[model samples]
Target chain A: MSNDKEWKRKLLRDMVVIRTFEETADKLTLRGKVAGGMHNSSGQEAVAVGTMSALDPKDVIATTHRSHHHTLAKGMDPKLVMAELFAKATGCSKGRGASMHLADVDNGNFGGNGIVGAGVGIAMGAAMGIKQLGHKKVSVGFVGDGGMNTGRTWEAINMAVVNKLPFICLVDNNQYAVETFIDRVTGGRDIAKRGAGFGLPSFTIDGQDVLKVNRYVKEARDRALAGEGPTLINALTYRYYGHNVGEKGQYRTQEEIADWRDNRDPIDRFSAQLISEGLLSQDEYVALHAEVTAQINAAVEFAEQSPYPDLSTIYEDVDSGLLGAKS
Target chain B: MSTQTETTRNTLPSYSEAFQQGVREEMYRNESIFILGTDLIERGGHFAQVRGIAQEFGLERVKDSPISEAAMVASGIGAGMYGCHPIIDLNFIDFSLGAMDEIINQAAKIRFMFGKPVPLVIRATSGVALGGAHHCNSLEVLFAHTPGLSVAVPSRAYDVKGLIKTALRAPDPVIFLMHKKLSGVRGEVGDENVLIPFGSAHTVQSGKDAAIITYGYTVVTAQKAAAKLAESGVSIEIIDLRTLYPLDEDAINETVKKFGRVVVADEAPLYGSITGDIASTATEENFKYLKGPIVRVGGIRAPISAHPQSAEAAIPTVESMINAVKKVLAY
Candidate 1:
């Protein structure tokens, strides 16, 4: 484990990089450079960063559609991720998968599934595979508040508990699923308690605090690796943007968004904590922000310059052709 | 002669037993292979297709999942993504509707999207057999329509054993559809490493007269119809397409050109059915060689009845195939 100063700096760097990348992606989408609409994790950075920080390089993770932060935090190359969003040939999925389907399997980031709550089973299976292979790696599945309503989530949770799979179910409760507030649709508002109902150790944490998120996730990971089965962590966060990029977000008032951004912004809270502890100076924070901005701008340039996949390559990778169907 | 007949009789097994034997053989060959589904470990599945597998492979390998088809399939996909080969037993084909997203979107598209091979097999029981709309369905067309999926509909014990083994070893995902009514149907299955490849069709009977093409349990009906038509001096040819998606277009073309008249039969609903796909392919490719329009014998466009008689009447019967053959010959 890193010291307090190193941890604060690393957390701050990850959060800023996520924020910068998302902001750049938003601009790119608006300008028609990015084909698919973007789902920015603007206010929900701390959850992804903290949870990912607790994971080892060998541990696998599966994310939801709003997955840029998770993908970046899981250590996927920013250049390749940006290229994928641009539909370039040099992308991670060879330009086949767009924003919602970013995956770096070699790096242990299984995928960013477009379907809600679908990753729960995938992560559970990965954990099962690890156990079968006699490895101690734990798999983490990230789902949104809306994903909890899906039947597959409960099924996966039950299976993980019964089988003693080393898995972690992270619920990012941003309080909404697309347009509707979660409470309006969900039978109950307490997302973390639902995990306990499935007979697993679970917790609800303040998602705006990166340190708290990191500590709780580390505990879960340790318990999982120690053969205690799965853990469900509900990170209470908020999305600053609408469900997608361009909407005005009329479902919730501007005041609510403003209150969250001002009083509960994860980046702001983390920055303040670092400054209060004398870990990061104001000058150092500004320089780090500038550095992340420059790095994101370079990634945008790389994506813009990257060539689109040739039309002839369209039929490639449909199947591995190991069984002799078209390659 | 009596001793030889007894030896031949001992070699034959029911469709379900052949399928179980195939799974057992593959599990023995590949240590990574495992089975999981709703009543697999406890009761050996609703159709008893996996009836003594849990005892042989142990409960750890033959897992009994919850009534969660989506998670079951998704977990299979995840396991397949890694180095494990999973054979997911979806009890009834109709129940696959609950897990279509995982089947069609995830399992079918994962390999294509990620450029990684997911070697998995989905064994689903299909066809109407004294069951209602929810229990009985031949929904292989839905899977065949998807690009990345390979579909296999085996009729006899011999074909099911070979096809199921092949599916387990295939590089991509395979949907193995077994007819529910044909579980008791017995056929001679040789004790050999018989692995049938997909995209190949079996010419059950050859003739110069009109041809009848079909798959699944309907192949049995088609063959029976051909035998009846033969009694009437009509030498109707029978072609059983084992796989649906990578259809043996060459076989369809060869039979259509030789016979000049054709009848396509399937157990699925008429609209957007596999039979329609076969008919369309035959007409499009063998239009110039056609002496008559291609006809389709399939299930009616209504909910399957729960009653036995009506349920049997819902899908194509031997009489329907025979009538279709005669109608095509007349045309």
Candidate 2:
């Protein structure tokens, strides 16, 4: 196989892995295996995979509550994330943080925040530190349409621009924030324009197209590393599930959901493009799906077998330095 | 005689000046230490607590943030997570409400949630004397209620200098409450660098009749009241609790047992106040030693009015402390 084929195959495999993981998470959540609430990123695979593919190993990312795809894309072990959802001691954060707070700092993924737009300032601060330390690295904050309406997001953008920090505000414009549509809540349809108002170079891209997202994110990363301040990329996509697992999603019509599922599926589009371009074969696609399914199944088995954290460790890790010590 | 000699050797600086000196020393020692807030760069902050810091540490280290308190505090948490020490100035304590989500949710819980240490220090000017509702508030009780945050309300210049240094170096997030009315008050701060650890209380004056537990500018008021009561042979022990969260329970218990009477004073609202917490703790722990009911002198349960008399009536004053002390003595 050629290098181009290998790259395409890898991207396809990552998207498959994300889809499989999120699908499994949705099932587990319904089965009452995963506590709290699970925010599944079933249809927004390309946004996570494409943007993460553009980042270097040292570059950092701060994700949102709906961040399973981002975690898998940033190279976190599937088993560890599954174990975290299982509330096992071996999970990331030592089972202290569940799905909404999954973080793997070793892989430069700062973790997902529960609050909307909360990660914006954190990513900007990390970018400011990177700039001050003279490191050629950028930080990306993945926010939802709900996060865009928050004042914290604009404040962070203004600060990033003023400080000329290396940062990217990736607004995953999935149309709806919970039940309310973006058009109903937001002042306008264009989320990227908010960044431009802060003097940032902003653009809008089709989130379903992996190639376009990868290209635009790579360009944004380049601009950031060159000390050109921050860029905002509003990736328009759709969610396959409700705001969280277990909800019937009574807000939208069945026809709209079916339309996105049939016509705008990121995986189906990417696979069709690959097969048409002769970069992938039908046999390879079937094998890739099998591989991802097996990988997800093994992760689920591992999480099911893992033990819960010890009750004695409840007070641990409250403060990084003073763990188990008095406040 | 020894206390007088120590005071003679120490430098006399106002609370604001002591804060400036402490920040300057820490910034000089730690390259990663930076201060950011509104009007901090050119104006040296609203109270001038960070005056001349930008000139000394360069504008890159001392930054002036926009009027965005939420970002200012959240950025501190982020910077601290990345191994940089950040000192964020909330222009007024009342403005902290604008950044409550950042302070109550993010800064206070991120370290615990992610299992990473965040050494972020927030300096907020608090009190109800000089300003109305918008500018004046003593919200240390709110911070003390938070699990991961350490709250310090230093009353004296000496304690402010030491506490600020200690807070900057602490492994946990800290909220340093500076009293607005005490900013111009001068006190003797030792020349040698010192760090006052959190959760410790100092006995401003030792007496046998009753214990007046207080913090922040109220400590000053308690001291004045204690002196006046001493003239009337009504002795009172004043315990200045510099830190609120890891409250010096040992010191409080000891004083409570010694005096057998208690009066808790604070500038916050009377209901659900830090003084109430202290009174509850003292009563629950040392109920046998109590010679009278634990009295509380705190802010009235209302918004601080702009009128001078109403403002004076809003918060606890030296007169109120004396009245509480006298009432407790009568018990």
What is each predicted model's overall lDDT from 0 to 1? Answer: 0.86, 0.85
- In candidate 2, how many Å is residue B233 off? 1.5
Q: After superposition, how far is residue B235 of candidate 1 from its true place, in Å?
A: 1.3
Candidate 2 error regions (>4 Å): A320-327, B1-11
Model 1 Cα displacement at B239 (Å)? 1.0
lDDT of 1 by residue, A134-165 (tens): 68789998999999999888988988898888
Residues B216-291, candidate 1: write the lDDT tens digits: 8887888888888889899978898988867888888998888889999887889888888788878998899988
RMSD of each: 2.0, 2.5
i-RMS, every candidate?
Answer: 2.9, 3.3
TM-scores of the models, in the order given: 0.96, 0.96
lDDT of 2 at A254: 90
Model 2: per-residue Cα lDDT over A1-327, one tens digit each: 698788877888999999999998899999999968689898999999889888897788888999889989988889989999888888886777789889876567777988999888888877877776678999998999899999989988888888888999998878899999998888866777767778999998999988889999999999988888899999999998999897876789999999998999999999999999988889989998998999999999999999999999887766543311333
- 10 residues in a row with least lDDT, candidate 1 chain A: A318-327
- Candidate 1's C-alpha runs over 4 A off are A1-4, A324-327, B1-7, B190-192
